[model samples]
Target: MQSYWNFPAAAGGTINSINNAGIETFKGNELDSLTREICQNSLDAIKDESKPVVVEFKSFKLQRNQFPQRAELLEAFNKCETTWKGKNPKSEQFIDQAKYILNEQEIPFLRISDFNTKGLEGAQTGELGSPWSSLVREAGSSNKGDSSGGSFGIGKSAPFANSKLRILFYSSQDLSDYQSHIGVANIMSFEKQPGQITLGTGYFTNNENSNAIPGLINLDPGFNREETGTDIFVSAFEPKDMNWVEAIRNSVIYNFFITIWQNKLVVKVDDEVISHENIGSFIAQLDDTNEDYRHVKNYFRLLTSEDSIQIPYPAKSYKKIGKFEEGEATLFIMKGEDLNRRVLMTRKAGMRLFEQNRISGSISFTGILIITGKHMNQVFKKMENPAHTLWEPSRFEEAPKEADTAFKDLRRFVRETVQQTFQAETTDTMDAFGLSDFLPDTTTVDGEGDDKKESLTLKIKSIAQKKKEKPKKKLKKKQRNEEFEDTLADAGIIPEGDQAGHSDEEREEGLGLGGGTGNTHGEQGPSDEGTGGAQEGKGEKEKNKPIDVEKRYVCLQKNEGLYRVNIKPEKKFEKGKLEFKVSGEQSDYILPILDVQSPDIQVISIDKNVVRFINLTGKKLKNIKVKVDYEQYCVMEVDLYEI
Candidate 1:
């Protein structure tokens, strides 16, 4: 066998380097191109339909290297080199030629022609041979014409900015030819000479060409039937440190799905279908209203080359109406040259102004702006001061008197409208929440008994008490069960029965009475009964009443009744006379019975059950009738006057 190691050195080494770099390197420029191609494809897909299209991002995974080494790599390289040499064109020369073709084509009208030497209008451009171009052709083509977003054909150079290896695959329909075709392009940067680059192209095959261009390749080789669509793959390349997904999302705004597709395209990245309807929906959601339709009335005119043409640009508007609660309107503009494009612009009229000194303009209107992709560098030229005065080309040009007056009127209208809607002069909190009328006019209370003036102290106190008392009942019940059961059960009983039989005769033997034994009546018993019974009965009667007899009481007769007294003779009277007083008053007073013959008061001895009254001697005295006031003894009284 021929030694595979002896194969062409240049080709094998190049292929090997690319294989080693892996998917990220291959993904490089190819990913960007794929994004652009898919966006373009979506636009083409929606050209003939009015229904909203749904584009989905499907699966994407990197595959390993599989290309052969040495001889096989040499053969592939030779084939590409031979084909490229056959064209006999430099890279810049090819770009110029492509531009010339686009400018000469008459398929669509060019909106602005400032690049033309005489600033002429309404010139025809020829048809662009292929909608897509490699970096070599883009750099070499002399004629800069409008077919897509790129002007100097530099848009194709964007993929090489941060990538080492790249691959791109796309499928499109040729409406004129009534067929579909699949195309693939791949590129790689050489390790030996980092500046050197290589590219390749090929097509797929299918039995039926009805759904594709006659000589075009079929995108899905396994599918027997032909379908009109495209797919792209970009691998092994590294993207810039910036967020690529956000960059792509922003690009979708300015370059609508239709224009990117070249009017006969349908593309997918990994597998996301890119369509105008889907892009429009995205823009609609972004603006949050139909107000964007008003801004869209203006046209984006891209002019290239000295002989470029300008045509009357028609404007289309779409509107959405709702309350003012929706967010402010935003407009996105993509402008500038490759590698230096500005991607975001907040001003309505100056969004896409570039800052790199290469391009200048304003993308201003009445909305928010996001400018991105390869064109940012050509639009805004300086980042130091990127305002309207610095970046907008219009600022440097003279304006007609009428135009100036019209612009002034428009500015006034915008200012007034913004004021009415946003109330910009007022504080943000006050305007946003409409709280101007909510503040209290006065802090002081107006009335003495206003309900709102009730104190919260009492309510708080009651709530605190209830919280403290709730746990006590549970504790008491638990203690009763554990410690107090027996005391409660035996509290109230009397003993009797067997004690009565033994007590009669034996109880008499212990008695101190002089009576003998049982039932017979005798003189000794009678004498004993009379004396002992009397003394015993007296003692028993004394025992029946309260004991600790400390005094003997006597009833003294007075004019109206009799009063009882307990006094010791030896206890000296403070005033040399007897005095009686009640609890409430300070004066001492004595009461006299009115009829001495029958006293109303009664007195009894310590153990006597009977009482006796004494007759009083009438004596004339100045204060004999002592007033015993009952007022001092009043405890509780009830009013019975109504009855």
Candidate 2:
């Protein structure tokens, strides 16, 4: 007998040729999309089980030629299963069939019970439909589920994108029967056409496959279990283009986990459990413990559908929730569906859902909803309709009357809550940082406080206003002058032009003087002829015989003081001569002759005992005597005074 097999004509071509011929296309944000998809699937699986779920990660590397591995296969299965989980049968049945086919190929898989996989059963035949039948059935009922974040059904192709490898997966779901379980094991191989991959299956055992594993193959001698749970094994997974640690951390931060009620969602990276911290708690702790973490908190709520609303519920009494070893206090209130949930060490309220008629329930820790980078852009695009008013109406007059009324009340309530919280926290922090002195201290009043509080606030405001309005006084000029003078005095100098003299007494003494005398002497007069006795005797003879004018002469008496003398003789007498004689009290007078013609004369030369006279001023004198030895003449003094 001869056997014949048919294959594609291009099957023998090189991987590069197959890749370039449109047989593979990998241009997608597949890694990011797949990570999210896988996380969602794990969450759903745990949610379905209604038990604690622990996802353990282990380090494994897939090389280029190692075409298939267990991790990659499990990742692919998760994507396909989650994509068709809640969809209608017609549209998603193909993917469902693919999963079933892959399960049938992975046979003789291991079952474990160490974690939560207790009470599980192995695969049983006659449970799932034929591979072809399941494919058709799944195709008829394909519709996307609510919890899936990715739009494209190609998320399953992500882990296989960059390599030629094969992956195997072993996973199980809890069965209703305590001793029975539904489980699957599968393999996926990457082809040259980038993200496009071929899937095959191994054995699965189940009491019945209720459209659970569409193309699953049944293994003989199914194993029985005492406890029930699922297990996943991933083999050849290509590392994502981006950093894996960052990708996993971000997915954990943003994706919804509110529906995880009974199960604890655990994620591990390379066999290490990633520590999950609530965003609010983390922020609060950072602020309280780290001085640098102090910053403003911006609160926002994002809602997708129009029917979603934020209803205001009445404020409840606050109660202290937790106390730190450092004496820091945390407070909270009992409200909303998650009222029993322990509020974190920080006092911020978590997200809460309120029912109609202002009743609250269903709280969520929405502090984790941080929109960043691409996610932020997506939100902006999605919220473009009516373009969030930021607490304002488009047209105030056109707003519905009922909505307006409710909005005003709600606004007041929200504002009050925010103000109160801000004040309380600010006070607490100021005390902690030793900055309380920088802020004003004011007593906070309760909701029922009176208008007097408003009055006190107004008074404080008035005081501040008055301070601002008061006028400043200008400096006086006199004071400035005095200050300048004082400075000059310190430097040691009298001011300009203040000298000592020019007093009143000096002027008064110089005003009293009059005027007085002048005197001159000396002239020669006629001499009397015939002296007394001779005259008497002669009188007898010729008593009156005329004395010859030229022959007889008598000396004239000299003036009492030193004098200048002048003499005149009668013109008719031909030899008349005038003689002047010096007399000493009627004794004989001796006359010494001196020069009568020279103008320059020395009256007496005392040492030689000589006397001479010279004419001065061109005047000639006939009878003048110069004496050299007379004591009175030699001692004479001449006095000339200002007349």
Candidate 3:
């Protein structure tokens, strides 16, 4: 069959945008997206239970004639060069690769093959919701089911971005048709120029066949005729990052470990093979210093029963349901190495939201919280943004109001769990609010015991005012007012001169500062004003002054020589930066060092025995950790609070 290169409608500037779209989907790490995207597609292609899915990545040198549709592909390459110069003004590699693919006898190519899977199969109608339609003919149309990992169908851009020639060949054996289909597409930025134009995204296929669409062929020498699978060949493949091969391997093993462990998939990179049997050894290649490695390793070990840790649902009482009864949470904690503090949270599918790290406080322990039940799935799913990185309830405010309530309950549950796990009895201030006193009957009443029966019941009552009769001794208006004033003067109802006629009861209720009356009862006291001052005297002038404005902190001695420092930001400073100095008084301790807990706060330096830092976080309050070091092998706790 005579082959011809068919190009799609070259919309003005549309190809430019599409060329950049795939690259933008994976901005930071190209290899991460590459591994994730290709692997996801392979998993979705799995249609056989008896045979395992095997994906292979291989590099080989192939002669130009070996390619089945070399003539049409060369035509496509020649056409790609017409506008390549204008598109990539400085990229000589583009011209070199294009010329090499067309003129050279031999070229290097990357072949990524997936075995024992249903290859891209569907009627080639250029229609939506078809694997063949989307993979070969469409750009962003998706045919993925709900359980599929990819949704946008833009993941193919990763491989295209990695290809030096911006051309990739798709060869797959449709199990139902029992026929192999070979196609090639070059997605790149192109300058629109008359009849020579093509939407950088087009197919290289048979031209003689009347039923043929763009970018399709019937055969290829590289196609595995004995097996049903797909092979994606990248002509002139080269990665910008030098260490991409190793990095991609590690990423693949780390990300697909769950699939590997279940014996569902196997990956081969060049000569080395990665499968469930040897997945652990492959994972060891990842940087051990990274918290990600530790998390994955520990998680895998936990699943395989290799680690010594026990995590159970929190005692039933710890799980609280809000008024909606929509969600409940349980915390599982363990004592392990003080690495990264993370709380692994999962939804109904058991896929954890990795970016959402709920752990607070120091990295002294590990915790895992499984918050699920009732309407939580609807709430969490609705809350998940496109990235699936967070459960931001605010993003879903337009959703049902119930979802907002459920989201709030989830947050409260997380906060309370974190406090219970980390802070312990440090919540005395919250307990001081006397909130429990307002709650309904918590304890059962005993009818037998008289004391238990005499529980307190608060009641609200209305009091009536009494009418007073006219005084027997009548006098003029001035005399009557004077008489009332004399009576009030004796009773100390009003202030007299600077002495401030405050009764003993009023004095007791005043500022409570030494002997002075704090504030009169049923009157506007200094405490009632917006400021900290009273309505009378100096208190009135100083009204609106904040209470507890002094800077105060509490230091808790953790170990014998270590202490945790907490600064009260709300009570002292609210805006701008704050500076504090900590000096060691002990003669034995020289050059005392303080280790900062949070990256948001910067620690300037430590000179001699003093440690200084400025609060970089503008938040109203923060808990800053200042670790005081003593002489080597010495046992003593430096008093930071006293200093």
Candidate 4:
């Protein structure tokens, strides 16, 4: 029975030492990597699409005497200890620990079994790209298709990394009715004889064909995988390390929650079943205080919340990325507080790759982008790093230009969506440690148009405080004309021949959304304020000339009525203030005079608007930022005061 174990002696110059660089890729993320890889592989081999794939993570103990090839393994360990006495201290220390573990009366092991899958196919043939070979014998080999969750084969190392003994057993009952078992040890080279060195990698098999045993061997008396699918066993699983269980549970919930939510996968950690039926319960029980845990909680919330906006990724992106076939995918965004401001990108299979971080805007939002078509999945899968965390441009060595534009297009699409949908720059102060991101008596109001939803930057106001606004004192025609002339003079806009196309009726009511400078025909800047300033002194001819303001951005924060405006000036100005106004189907009007705050721009006087802010800062008045406060409303518009 023990004759099948094989560890051949290497030639004189060749020596097999322990090289765990593959496993080391998952060093700090052992359990997560393991959980993610196992479920992904299982999902890839779904035999029945109607049934959910079930996986069990359980622990069992076996006596040392029942361990197969105990004597042969002990001899190898003893030889390794003697041969590498002082050469490799780490290896020497590891071998000492492994030897001690082997001598214990009962050893603990973890068996991960998956059911309702085709299992490892082509087990009868040890081909280079066979599932069994790719998983057990070969390194960095995969025959999975585009729809599959992963292609880079380094994921198999995760399970081995989890083993303190650096040993694992692979047993599978393939759908073809073939059952086989194999034991692989990743250890250091050992001196088999006085002058002979055996290879570091050893196999436990019986015959000349050392790939696999005929049938599954009994690992534990009560624990066995009688169903179809694969079972991976890790020796010296560190049963005393309860942290491992927690790590496994967290990983399952974080990475596979979508899979479970879709009824495509189910995970069991020592009888604690995490399935589609209980995903909400599991998420509700999680303490979102843990930043790491909060991500999945929020993601799950976005998945189920009807408030989430489903925006499809552009079909043009497929063509821009040099792909012929179009793929369908959606980015679901939930705009609110308690968000990480990142987008989670997942394969169509429902297993997430990673949260795409540093999304361009400061919107109080988090999202999930599900890549759901075969061709598109293939495109992104190729661009993914070995870890599948980000979409890197360097991956497209053939066409670097397309790679360059792909990211720009993605970001532009997201920006355009936000502008078209939210119609405002959104941001919020994340809860300062211990403080809740929630408020009592939250309120929401209807947006401007049929399509517009609640504004992300809109502040909450109670019904009691939301009484009708006090009407603005109607200004006389002369006063309105004079005010209009002053605003035009400051904006450097001398309207066409006196009043362009305005009548006494229009002039008497208010500015009446006057057309001039850059802000005519309703072009809101999406951020800072509506266009037209001292900068636009001339028409298209002045396009190349410098302006008083180069660029600016406006952000509406959580604080009631607070707005932060960032301004970059093209030229120096001793002072400038941003005036506020409102215009719509109704005649244009001014906001009720309120408080103003700024580091650079001070309240010289608040008639309608006055900042002529800060000496305009920066020696040359290069750029200045200001935060102002007033009654909050989405219709508010701004204008840079007298230059």
Highest lDDT against the true fold, candidate: 4
Of the pair 2 and 4, which is ahead by lDDT?
4
Model 4 residue runs over 4 Å out of place are 1-3, 12-16, 239-241, 317-321, 324-327, 336-340, 357-363, 424-643
> How accurate locally is residue 411 in candidate 3, as Cα lDDT from 0 to 100?
45
Tens digit per residue, CA lDDT, model 4, 4-96:
457776677567556677878988767788888888889988889999999888888879987777877888888888888989888888888
Ranking by lDDT: 4, 3, 2, 1
Q: Per-residue alpha-carbon lDDT of model 1 for 179-207, expressed as tens digits?
A: 33322223322222333333232222222
TM-score of each: 0.29, 0.28, 0.58, 0.67
Backbone clashes for every candidate come to 92, 64, 14, 10
Question: Roughly what TM-score does model 3 have, to 2 decimal places?
Answer: 0.58
Tens-digit per-residue lDDT, 1-643, candidate 3:
6555555554444554233666666756776777767877887788786656888877776677775566766565555567665556543355556667656777667778898888777634434567877776666766765445555567777777666666777766667744445455655544434644555655556652212333323233453545667778877666667665676788777667767776777888777788989988776666778767877675555446533343333322112322323234444444345433445555433334552232343323445454454344444555665444466556555554555455544445554555465565445444446666765443435455445443568786977888996644421222222223233334453223213332222222211111121111111112222212123552224222222211212223434333333232223322222222232333232325556564545554443344434545553334445555533222222211101
What's the lDDT for all of these models?
0.26, 0.28, 0.51, 0.66
- Which of the predicted structures, 1 or 3, would earn the higher lDDT when compared with the native? 3
536: Cα error in model 4, Å: 27
Predicted structure 2: clash tally: 64
